[model samples]
Target: MSMKNLDRHNRWRNKTVAFRVSPEEDEQLEIFVKLSGLTKQDYITRRLLEKEVVVQGNPRVYKALRDELAAVLDELRRIEAGQGVNGELLDTIHMIATILNGMQEEIAYGN
Candidate 1:
């Protein structure tokens, strides 16, 4: 063989990992793979390597939450310095706290 052919032969990926899946399972896998924007092989390989495969979620919720929390903390600091607090600031803080508490309880008592 030529040098290029010899190098290519030596670098072949000679491993097989196979499994059987039902149509439903195949459909689910394809959905996730498409969302991940990775080829099926790369997706499966990354999963086997325990890489984090991100999927979309309520990003707007989280972003709003983080912004509210920052605002609340800034207001808190101003209050601690004996500055007058706005009623709306207090309301926002209370609302976010309630939502966070609910999430915590759900996590603690998930089905």
Candidate 2:
């Protein structure tokens, strides 16, 4: 190809952006970076540039899941109000949130 054509092709390629992240966030991102088979920078760049689609869930499924989550929160509140909270339960909630967040990110950004 001609030099001009090669330059044009290069111009159409994606550009990079740089920013700092917290150490904890960087550790989490590293997990996803490996899972996605992408470098951390490429994964972050692609995710930032990607378009997202938000689909409405099945009404019954959505309602059931919402109710279940509410019930968990309610139980958590009761535990908090009573005397103390279970560390295991709190950890489970955090893990669930992380998983859901990762799935959401994949759905929104994955090719």
Q: Encode model 2's per-residue lDDT on 1-111: one tens digit a residue.
A: 445433323753344457888876675565444434444555675678793322223454345445546756986788878767755446545544654576578789862
TM-score of each: 0.45, 0.35
Error of 2 at 57 (Å): 27
lDDT of 1 at 50: 100
Q: Which residue runs of candidate 2 sit more than 4 Å off their true CA positions?
A: 1-16, 51-111
- lDDT by residue (tens digit), candidate 1, 13-105: 446689999876685566445444456776787798898754332555466567667767887898999999875666566656665676677
- Misplaced by over 4 Å in model 1 are 1-57
Tell me the deviation in Å of residue 4 in model 2: 18
Model 1 scores worst on lDDT over the 10 consecutive residues at: 1-10
